[model samples]
Target: MKRAVIGTLLATLAMVAHASTPRDLESSAVVDGTLVLAKNGTVQTVQIKDEARYGKPIADMVRKAALQWLFYPVLREGQPVLAKIDMHVRVVLQKAPDGNYTARIKGATFGDMDAKSTDALSNAESNKRIAPRYPIDAARAGVQGTVYLALRIDRSGHVTDAVAEQVNLANIGPDSALRQFRDEMAKTTLAAARRWTYQVPTTGRLASQDHWTARVPVTYTLNDRGEANPDSVWRTYVPGPYTKAPWSDKSDMDSVDAVVNDDVRTEGAGPALLVSFHQG
Candidate 1:
């Protein structure tokens, strides 16, 4: 049975790796978080470093998806050691007509943040945002996740420079399958983000700052997979001007489930748990 299980997993990994990598897609979700790795390579604890900029669901999704991920552990002298790693994941999510969404991991890279950089992004806002198009080929193959991008914004609120850093594909597959569609998704992400504009960063005094580095995350979700619809895997909730949030943010007593899963529920009107990363 162990052999069977390993073989099955390897087979799945190969299949996903062979799918087309995103080379032309234009939207992505850039996630910032930290995870504590156990000596055995399993995730011990995880946290999203920035939760203030986004709503609660975003962070919850990031952490929950993170808990299910397998990490490439830090080794010392050929032995694994307990390590804390800061990660910036670029995620891509596809949207559905109804707004309910599902996503897969796009890519993950190990890195940490500097205090100055985080402070600069704290006050920026989206002025003109563009979403990524669901890659037709990826959809046919049932690919989904949040695509992450790193951008430099000027005082004028224009995206001065943008780079397709990586996608947070922790959920895509345990192997190279995650790379298959990365380029396609990245192309879609850059094409859209280049046209986006943001509110210039400001001092607490409300003065405009010269420049800021921003992480742009685009998501693609699919609530259901339609074997018939190649893009049916692109399930995500994009709130329309006319709709309200599917989950409540205003209840006095919010109900939260697993700290790291999507099945979480909140009651009152407030942001979800978007906290900073620490030793936890």
Candidate 2:
């Protein structure tokens, strides 16, 4: 059974590795087009003259194609306003050297934000403004916690101010100790937050009320483990390779375990007695 299990594991790993590797397509078709949305929000047209063809009518192919275009309104005084946008789609067909087609599908662009021009603002300026008010001692012992702050970016291309929305360090023990750390960090971090800058749209004039909210995730790691060192406490307490087979019991083991040992403990079992029983 052990040999069979090992063989199965090796086979699964081989399959996963093979699946992860990139494969070349057998045939390819390149489709390119520009989609234009009118300012009135009533007229929409997609020009596919430059799009690739695969022996199908242009109108018929476009109608059946999975090409989509979206436009967000430029608001004015809490009212919807018109905005114009041009979108492009590309389809590539991959074919084998033996002259045989393998797959045919329409390709898509990266994303809205990716295509937009981002040279107006610098990330360093933004980071400097939003930098934490306090230096988190990530190397300190028993310092695992999350500090969440709400930041507002104004139209003037500046990180206005940051507020300590929430701080979670419950498992670190003792409220007073955690509060002291949180207060110090908040003070130092908030001071640096004033330096962060943002780039506003050059075309439109924004009112003082116009602002965007951003949430930052800060993680503190005291140690590292895993293949580097087996005796590391970080790796022991953290997640590791699964020793038990995923499909061994052929059942929802997690749900079954939750239902079985919710809060029911036998008086004599004690906390040390970890019962290993299977549930169908």
Candidate 3:
């Protein structure tokens, strides 16, 4: 996806947090005060209730809470002045689907480590890490082959290995060229893969372990006249590194990728072949 589109999508996703209610609110209070817009556009406030404690004296949080209460000081001919404001402390509760209970704080959104980390996994970050080694566009134009690599990501968010899972280039006029191209692309992609970082949420003070399996499709196309088509595509399939092996050697090798390729023959006029150099 384009960068702008991806950014817009992420923005939309972030807006979802507004609709989310805080799990606990009884412990939190809303500090009500009149927001006096100073001549310099800064807000000045007078605290009406001094009994409430916000754990930490964070000015930003206090200002945000005050703004939500709609307590702005009255202005005279665009002149700003200080005014009194009402603040209240209320206890809020949220009932979960499992009959569990949680505290809900008004105007406060609970921070979810998982959601935060997931949002950080932007396409730009992925591209920056993956582009150099794979040189995706160039590899596709040079050789008409598909290389499948299985990537193993360690707990440290590093690509430990990217082993060749499959290579499909049966009908190419020169198999050696296609194979070499596949090997080089595989090496490049794997080399870049090591630099890619996956998102891992924090579990309390410690970070939770995380791993991801992603498939990158690289295609080389040839027109009816045997010229590079630029649209022919091949894909890389990385099975779940953290989950159970989807297909064991003792089990049937037929997978969703295999089934789909079986149904659609590429320009090579046959189903794609997956030759495993080393079994996982």
Candidate 4:
């Protein structure tokens, strides 16, 4: 069966305090898990892989929210059937005017890990993921975002063309200024991506094709405090518009907007969510 994702509006949850703090106004964390959905489309069970790493309060809140989520049924042969999806949830931390901090569900996305889509190229090796240099202006301004990239690779595994499909900014500002930054970042990412190479599938259905188009994301972030960016913690950003690549298949446009930081230097990374569940 051709893989497909159920479409729905983004969900937001009410803010619940995790701890009292006035230091930072906004931050986010990504929670990875597996969700088992019943034929009716309700989440039957969820197992968070690193639940303890996010603390009990946040863990409990995530679990509660997951149970309440409703999804369109996954169909096999035109019949609703049980399905399991790998999900990634971005939990944002916000500080209220009163100096109290609360955690809320920012966004979530579902994907099938076992999907064998021939349209997307696979990563060759871990070391092959060469991260692009961060734009100087963006770094000076503390601007961060993920650049969704569309790359055209020849059968010989060399990138022949590259384009920035979208650029989501972490910090907010006027639309004009945001566009400027997006252009700057996209330019830098495209420069680097043009030099990238991928592994062509030898046994897949499209191996004989002259070229393959692949989609990836490149993230630009700063770690000024001498600490590596935590896998669990994510930067909250405003997503940019999706631009279809000229050589891309129209079906590729159906991808969700939720992007994860893991996509920055990795290949075939799952979608990272960017929706808010609740408002307080």
Candidate 5:
């Protein structure tokens, strides 16, 4: 369920935290756009919406990679239908020993821009969110990462249960030490999530359901200064092992990771992508 943004460690490592610093200047990046699909699931057109922000080099790599992608055909009442989808692609540039770099598409997620049109899980119009406090141990050690949380909400828009689905660390270290740090970050995130609430869908297919499932990621950065913009660029990170929520049917990993910005992704609300999105 985890996407390894960086293929291989580009630089030598040490047991210390700063030893994990990236030698190459090219950091991980994210690009998003709309993809038009034919009835048979072939990509008819690809648009690079964030080229100016991500730069042409990164945008071109994502565009070429996306053209070769094939998705599961969308169906309406067992009949094939043409569809348009919003896609977010994560790119990582790895420098080889020969001093050359290669762009790899680690993962991509496909869904509809408007969630209300589909019966699948979608976010309500209103919600109250509380940012999690940076753990003292992690902050002191200069640890930074993003924690994706899976939440179960009742019809009343109250969080009934919350779990940390995955934690990706911007810093790297020994496997044992990284796991312990991730746990500390997850603990704090879950505590804050319990106090949050959201508006339930009143018009969609899931509105009448007894409960809804939603996923949102909380990021911790040392230089955020309380005005964090996650979509500007993605920092390299080592993805931790994914923990599935007890109420989840499968590990819906791709949908949540595609959210480069601060937004809640409701389950089952967008067009279903049947094929694997890994391009690396």
Candidate 6:
């Protein structure tokens, strides 16, 4: 059923750190909101904290998921206290072979959780990555966030399978326009991810592992100018047989391409906000 997604307020979430990210299932839905809990720790209800992105569809979804949420009541002096807190929730969207889509909650974050988070975000640093082109639709709409991927790397360092794990957009709403853009953007990311290959470690530290299966995070952020410059780059990779990335032009070995700022280059790529969860 369609639901209203919780919003991101200027407020904060204080979730218990005992519960962390959910590793299984599929669907990409991240949310930000507040929970009003009864003194006994029972959830009274939730309210969307951010400006409404999508009108009715997501709000309804938010309502449904909130009802199923299990929160530990905040206790003080050995008793429950009515509490209001801020949080972020992420859900996974699973696409079957039939191309049908289904959603599942992947993770949620409390603004006041901990200095240490178990959700380890591993951006592929060692592999050569090609930065994806910002989709015209997304760029025009100024959508930006990270895209999480599950990659199966074979012994040869080739990406045997690369799946679009999640999208984490922050500035945009989940309206029909934004949703359409995210869908198109996901396709671009998946295509670029599949073509990635890393140099397999034959000798040094990783000699024991036969194949590496891991999560890769690719972030797509617009340049500070709010425009896709295709030149606003931050990191420069050394040009050579050993360190060249896809976004680099072989002839331009001395300079890193200005493909980012709003661009994400994937050798393996991989934020936060109380409000917009990349793909609402």
Winning model by lDDT = 5
lDDT of 4 at 252: 38
TM-score head-to-head 1 vs 2, winner: 1
lDDT of 4: 0.63
What does candidate 3's lDDT look like per residue over 112-213, in tens digits? 212233422212256453543433432333333444444444555555545545444322222333344456555665576556664432332223435433
Give each model's whole-structure lDDT: 0.48, 0.35, 0.35, 0.63, 0.71, 0.45
Weakest ten-residue segment in model 5 by summed lDDT: 5-14
lDDT of 1 at 26: 27
User: For candidate 4, what is the TM-score?
Assistant: 0.58
Error of 6 at 70 (Å): 26
Give per-residue CA lDDT, model 4, range 1-280, as digits (tens).
1112101100100011122332433466678788888888778998887788777888888888888777777666668788887877777777677967699776565665564643345665642566677776566556667788877889877889877877877666555566777998899888877877776756533567788766666777666652234333545566677787787653133342344454422223332222223421
Query: By the lDDT metric, which is better: model 1 or model 3?
Result: 1
What TM-score would each prediction reach against the true structure?
0.39, 0.34, 0.32, 0.58, 0.76, 0.36
Per-residue lDDT of candidate 6, residues 199-233 (tens digit):
54444223456655444456666665766433211
Residue lDDT tens for model 2, 1-280: 2556434433443343223212321122223444443443332655554433434453345434422333343344656544333322222334466956444333232112223443122244336435442243322323333344445667675667566444433123233444555654455555765575555434323232355443343433333331111111111111111122221232221211111100111111111101221110
Q: Assess candidate 2 and give its TM-score to the true structure.
A: 0.34
Q: Which model is ahead, 2 or 3, in terms of TM-score?
A: 2
Candidate 1 residue-wise lDDT, 1-280, digit = tens: 2556545544675475445433332234556678887776677898887565444777787788767666555555657688776665545555455855555445444432333422234323442335567766556555665454556667676767776544544233543444555666677877887777655434332244455555545655543552323222123321111111223222111111011111111111111122211211
